[model samples]
Target chain A: MSLLEVRNLKHKFRDGTEALRGVSFKVNSGDFIILAGKNGSGKTVLIRHLNGLYIPSEGEIFFEGKPIHKQIKWVRQNIGMVFQDADSQIVSQTVWNDTAFGPENLRLPKADIEKRVSNALLAVGMMELKDHSPHNLSGGEKRKLAIAGILAMDPRIIILDEPFTNLDYTGIIDILGQIVKLHKSGHTIICVTHEIEKVLYHSNRLIIMDRGLIAEDTLPEKGIFNTHKYGITPPMEEREGIEIVRDMTWLK
Target chain B: MAEITVFHFQAGNTLIYRLNTKLKLLLLLIYSFSIYQLSLKGVLFLSAFIFIAVSGTLTKPAGLIRQMKGFIFILILIVAASMTSVTGDPLFTGLPFPTREGLLSGMLAGWRFVMIIILGLIFTTTTRPNQIHAAVGEILKPFPLVNESAIAARMSLTIMFIPILMDMLNEIREARKARYIEGSRNPVKNISTITVPLISGVILRAGETSMAMESRLYSGALPGTKQAVQRKEYLLFAACLVPVVPAFLL
Candidate 1:
């Protein structure tokens, strides 16, 4: 059995608009799925459903062969989501406070919470600013703090929506490396982005969404064609002088 | 982004900075309500002491005065009004409006308010918001019929989001400027454009905050992390009272 399976998921907003028509997919352990789509293409809406943030209008989602709705708390505990907007996801004052929020919510022991928060901040290279206020952080720092907040929860499946948004070049490299590291460390990841080229070489599978439907679900090599048709920019062809490095690794 | 440090926390590791947050929070509440009892001279002494000691966390005296110039302006207005309205012995030979007693009274009242504000600055600059949040939870635990953790969580978030909302408003202003629609002769029209977007954005932010909280498994109560009050907290509390009690007595 697959780790997570979505069956014909559908959702309609109160404004008479369907955000997700009928989407289905299965995610296995250690799969790094890159969800790519244009604006208003239901990529975000679909990922939100995976973590039980939104109830599907008509369909069932299962985790480990059990219905998600029956045990959404478990689903949420297992699937951590980093939102597209870093500012929106930030609900705490300090870096350490925000990072500890997830573990604290689980009512873990004080020692456990502290160790988890410290490790998470260390993982994201934010331990130096542990006591600093979250609002004063730069865009890239805020993004990293958001990721650390989810990391403290130690979820098995991590979902990132436009994680590269508003990041500088170094920030992009740093975050992409972190995502790849998470995948290599046995955490399943689903990263949604329009900037496919930055993450294409790292992701194993590609899932494209268009008009609230899964336009294509295939390997990254084959799905490059599907991205362009769905209004996403395909990875640039190797320049005349520069060579593509297929064996490039982003570890550490 | 604008960075205002009037009441914002600054990280430090000085001896005073290491004071327990519970001690600072308790002192803050006590001084806030009891400032009127302190003599004007005592208030002045306390303010000067805070200015000198908190140089590590807060700006210098001159910088603080500059940042609080508007407040000083209000104080001047109050003194001027008292001089003109009250009947007292004149300070100058020919200036009957400038009375010494009215000036003293005005200064006394104004300094009371200023002293409380300065104490608040001291409290915030030394203590982290999370520390204050936890302290508030500890303080509210004794009271019945109150969800201490929930209220503490709300209060902390409210304090932290002030700068964020300010940033959002600044973004809206910049966006307006970029579109070249920021300059309207009609004050109402100009204010409306900013106000409409700000209110809507705040509403959207409120929704987002709730979803974020929910996603993190927040179940109407924060996790318990309270520890035993230390001997140093008690010592600090007593050390603070020793100065203030004598200030009121003498």
Candidate 2:
């Protein structure tokens, strides 16, 4: 069964600008789906609906056969989202406390919260810096901490929006490694980004949107066409003396 | 760049750092109360002692001193006001300045102000921001009308954002320099260039935080078990209250 299904979804802002125009899609369990588009293409607005952040003006979203709006809390718990700005997402002073904020909100037992926080920090290689304030961390580390905060919630589906923005090369690679790791661990992943070169090789499916509509939805290899037309970078398989290495075996 | 460190909590294994945040807060309250009752000479000596002692423990004592640079002008104004406002037997009759009473009163007031500032610095420097949040939350938990956890979380976020705001200001200044507008004489243009972007950035950040909080299922307050206070914490609290006894007696 599909974990999430959106049918004829449409959203219009209060200012009368249409953000999403009858977008429909299905996300199977444990699938890595990449949503690609240019600025104002409605990539973010669509994912915001998945977590019930925005109510649809038309159509509906279903989580395991039920409408998502009725179960906003459950949808949020199961579908975790890591936003673009790491600093804004981090609300707590220390790394551990920030990671614990989600579980604490769930009112989980202390022992369970502790275990989840430790595991999440360990997964992100941030256990050593758990005591440090999130403000002191580098930009990449802050992004990892944000992901760790989501992982502590033990969500089934993880969504990240423009995770590589304003990051150095090493920072980008670090976040990419975490995304790949999460995908391998059987978490259904949905990432939204205009920059496709770094993450395209790993994502199984690519969905492109343009002018508030889904332009294409297919496998990454077949979805490269008309990408530049929508202001997204098309996949570059090879360049002079340097090849795009899709197999990330070295990262393992 | 290093000035930013003065406002942040410094991690350490010292006795002051290890004390519970609630105990430190109580001690600060008692200390502030006691300062008013103490003799002027005693206040001066105590403030100097704390300034020297805390400076000795810090890795960069200069940072602590640098924090006082902005207050120097205010301190001078306060001293001048006290000196001019009070009249008595002058130290040198030929001079136009006030008498010994004004000098003593100004000195006492200045020392009191410095002492209170030092106490706050000591508290913030030694205690982590989360500890302060937890302490405030715990203290407010008994009140039925308040959402202690939510308030605590907001307080902690505010503390964390201070350094971030400072960093943003520095970045904006540097950007201005890069654009060759740092030396612009027009005050309106100079201020607008920074304030507009800073306010916009803050609003955007706040909106993003609200979305992130909603996605994390943060409704109003986070519910979590509190940490158990040790027997040693009681001892520390009692020790902190010792000075208050003398103040009451005097």
lDDT string, candidate 2, B107-223, tens digits: 778878777877877776677776887787998889999989889777766766766676676778789999998999998999899999889988888888888998999886656
Q: What residue pairs clash in candidate 1, if any at all?
A: none
Give lDDT: candidate 2, residue A249: 23
True contacts kept of 2: 0.61
For residue B237, model 1's alpha carbon misses the true position, in angstroms, by 1.9
DockQ of all predictions against the true structure, Cα-based = 0.50, 0.47
Clashes of each: 0, 0
* Candidate 1 displacement at residue A26 in angstroms: 0.8
| Candidate 1, position A183, lDDT | 85
What lDDT score is found at residue A40 in candidate 2? Answer: 95
Worst 10 residues of 1 chain A by lDDT: A243-252
**Which residue runs of candidate 1 sit more than 4 Å off their true CA positions?**
A237-252, B1-8, B37-42, B56-114, B172-194, B246-250
